[model samples]
Target chain A: MATAALTLYELAAADAALRFSPHCWKTRMALAHKGLEAERVPWRFTEKAAIAFSGQGMVPVLVHDGETVTDSWAIALHLEQRFPDRPSLFGGNGAMPLARFVNGWADTVLSPAIARIIVADVHGRVHAADRDYFRTSREQRFGQALEDVVADRPANLAAFRRALQPLRRALAGDAFIAGPAPAYADYCVFGMLMWARCISDVELLEPDDPVSAWRDRLLDAFGGLARSAPTARG
Target chain B: MATAALTLYELAAADAALRFSPHCWKTRMALAHKGLEAERVPWRFTEKAAIAFSGQGMVPVLVHDGETVTDSWAIALHLEQRFPDRPSLFGGNGAMPLARFVNGWADTVLSPAIARIIVADVHGRVHAADRDYFRTSREQRFGQALEDVVADRPANLAAFRRALQPLRRALAGDAFIAGPAPAYADYCVFGMLMWARCISDVELLEPDDPVSAWRDRLLDAFGGLARSAPTARG
Candidate 1:
């Protein structure tokens, strides 16, 4: 029995050192949780050609054992099955659906809310070649200039914080969202916060918020994997 | 060993047969999932004295033997810990926190959105002795009449449906939110729907929506426990 090489194409900022796509971060954390290290190939938004082999324009594309898996959620599921002897990504199969719900919440609600507050900052930090593409697509989707979308950031920040009440309440009596230890559910949310921290200056959460505390724990997990990641936030 | 006798005080409408409180419904579904039956006692909002022994004014108070439990979340936890051999409500201890997050989301996000759409209907259905108390307390909280709060129901309904994107996305790949089988997580969302159905004529979900399908399955679960329950929705 032989193990195959693993590689992950992750979204990167202008510096290339700044790898910060929320979806990609989820895959990164899941890999670390399984005690596996993959070569992270830095990818820019305009560099769709690099990931074409995966048949998708988006990344967090994982090439494992010469097999291609796209989408962060699918990659996470793949890792769990491939490394059953390692720490379980979902605690057990029964928890998978619940974790999926949390994954959906992060994708549909959490990340979208955070993106509105940091879209301008994200545009500013992208590679020069990707700036126009980023702005045009995002601006059209939002139906406004990125600058205008983020102009009322103070209000956006409040709304974002208010949206976090459920997470805060859940963490009040537990150490992590999945219970005693961090799991895929924690990764789903930390990935979003890491994305915000890596490419934006806006502090989406207050220092005292329980969610902020939970984020701190995740940052310190896996030998400070997320804490050591490149950041644009001061 | 003798098992403790269990009795649940559930919220009821003027008819006493129409039990509709979302929190109470959570407990009901949980008990049924565990295959445990408890005597259901009808309680009205103004009848706080009936539950005074629990040191709380809320319904869904569980009295087992000489022990008393208040709050739906607490009672669910108690039942799981006390009846370990019965069907697990959260799958396992590891899934508890994730279920708690779902519980919190149902309480803070789902129920509040539904409330704004059906509050006036709720006020109209409570026991006559409780109408003034329900209307006054809720009106004061909203800073407007209940009718005014729900007057623009078309807009409120749209917002409520939009808020369900995550739930809908989660159900796309699985039959239940907790995955292949129903669990506490399913109960959390179903309870809110039960509240709307029991007290309001308004349709909170489109008939073709996946969420509605999931709700229908829950209604038919546990030998039609929820299905047999009274509903005001035609």
Candidate 2:
């Protein structure tokens, strides 16, 4: 007589005016694609103490209602269960397996390398315009040699291409990483570098690459919305 | 009254193996704790390529009946759903949230830094003795000046320590990262650095840290069970 009894709770939403982060952006982008909206809570860099309240130690945490959802993958799982009708962000049949693989690749392979590449580029050549952000936050982490990270960009970016080679191979024929449409894996990978692509000259991906092109398709789907989403927050 | 032809597949066993990874050890540890039996398949260096057949990029994957489950986190999820009677590897009412958070942190925060320190140390000082195992795998990706990576180390390791500062606060009085018993997060973090500790002459985790003590407790619970298991044919 009883089903799973899974009453869905909306996680941090876009309306909260939260500072966009790579981790959060991926999930948000997924929500955008899936047409599922949740309440947003802006996470500030200075609010380290507040953020750590979950004890999971980061943002993009989907607190389905009051109980916090940890890990982007788990959040993805939660999203699918909550919104089964719109579309399976993961494909239907064989695509689920493919999605599983690509998702893992995103989390394990592309995510970490892209993170390093993003930071170096963002805090380096791009952030020169707004030097204080880097000087304060990155300085605390990497100290003074932020210059070296920038200096070796030609080489480091080469490594980025190398790291991305696997994704390139995986997404060669498909419109998306898992299948014909963008799934959770697509958003997860795209989420990390979007901010860098947004604020800086660093083009980690290209419109030519199928993966990049697919991302453009998503942008066309969302950018009109991210742009038109009552920017004045009425 | 007829069911929807549900084939009640009574708990089938699966086989999962790692390619000389101590991180893989955690999966084995769980299998042992649950007393779940699986076939063993040991792999070599780039020998992990076969894991792709499982529709995943890397090990340690669990193949149950016909379904191939990849991603260690996903495997744990599958195991919990398929086998719910085991002593919960994810502890407490908050176990799921804790598992997701800690598991994510283990991969993101701890593994990257630990991997850097381990690779630099292993390839720099101990390359000769370890030469037999890793003939093809180079110390650095694309030969990107290990010196730059190496040069980045002192700073990187310091930042690594800073990341750990959050954990120190998390584990001040708690027996585990989330509770008294070790959970998926503990194993996840432990798995990433297992080989680093086993192979490295110097201590990887700070000797005085509560995490070190916590890790030791986990080690005792594991009791070297992860490294060796009885194979189907053995």
Candidate 3:
């Protein structure tokens, strides 16, 4: 039986080629890790109807062989279970829960810290249809205008870097967060930084930082899949 | 040839039975998880000469068959390497690097946050000979007296609890950070909480928090090894 082609709805910028959502990047990297190819569908934030079939309003909505997976973490799990013979995403069963902790840290701590530094830039790069929705939702979340939220980018950037001490220390002895190789844990964090990289010009990491070196390695991973993506800065 | 008994130098309080150092608790839990018995030697902070042979000024210095291991992380790695046949501290090779991230998070983020709330309490519980040294070192670190460091206890306590959000989220779906069973990752964070529990009367975790429940499970782990420890509150 022929397998149906996997389709991924990714959060795209005004130029659909610029896919920058951190969560979607996680799925993108996971697919590349698993050696799976998917048909990329550029999605705007306000295009809820586009992914309504997934029973959720999220950009990382993956349609795999007629099965719909909404969350990025779930998509990675689906890919892992579906393609057990491929390179492992979590490395082992033990790492799945541990990766979840990394996922949680990225979601609650790292991404939020990056968001404060890049949300305003994000607003400028999003699709015209997504601009109002993104600005409105973010303004409500930050309780200020998008520009105002990033008005103190210097302090926000410092706090963001400080929040990365754990990641920095973790990478001090290893090439990647998952060990010597890039895996879901590294993807979980790299996706966030990718979000900033794709949408903003602000330098988030110093070149001398261990995290920057790790990010460079990841950018060169899977034949430079993430590096090839179009960035707003470009 | 008979194997020599393992000896662990653990940081002790005014009453030697009240072992309160967070790092020591990590080694303690790792030892129990590995099902290895070690003779606990009570070490006070002022007595740096006591562990001079190890070339370190810290407790949790594990002396195994004449091989001395300093630092909680090093001891854990030593135990894992020395007893590969036993229950794994890291569930698999993939988990070691991932667990290091957890260790780093506990060390840099969680422990420091907890110390702000409990430093004064910790100062009160150290051995009389160690009190002056402890207060002086901590004051120098905080740039203020111990009492003044924790003067904003309510705010510090709230911040500490907020810092546990990642842990709380991680434990929400699994019983332990290493998945269904407790491993080095769980021990790393649990050791920090145990530090607060043993030294401070300040209530760190709320009753209904998932983290509190996870802590309950660890307290009951290894036939209630941690729960059996004497807290300064009593």
What is the CA-based DockQ of model 1? Answer: 0.79
Best by DockQ: 3
Residue pairs with backbone atoms closer than 3 Å in model 3 (clashes): none
Task: Say which docking band candidate 2 falls in.
Answer: incorrect
Clashes of 1: 0
Which portions of model 1 show Cα errors greater than 4 Å? A1-4, B1-4
Model 3 misplaced stretches (Cα beyond 4 Å): A1-4, B1-4
Which digits, one per residue and each the tens of the lDDT, describe model 3 over residues A96-209? 899999999999999889999999898888888888899889999989988888999889999999999999899887899999898999999999999998988888998899
**Mind giving the per-residue lDDT tens digits that candidate 1 earns over A81-122?**
888989999998778888898899899888878988999999
lDDT of 1 by residue, B70-100 (tens): 8889999999998888889999777888888
Per-residue lDDT of model 2, residues B1-234, tens digit only: 121111111111122221225556667656656666666664433444556677645667677766777766667777667667777665432234334534555655566666666565445333243444442354334254444554766676676665565456446535755355655656766676565654444456678877687667766775646334322222
Q: Give per-model CA RMSD.
A: 1.7, 11.8, 1.5
| Error of model 2, residue A139, in angstroms | 6.8
All DockQ scores: 0.79, 0.03, 0.87
Residue A231, model 2, lDDT: 20
lDDT of each: 0.90, 0.54, 0.91
Note the residue pairs that clash in candidate 2. Answer: A13-A39, A13-A40, A18-A42
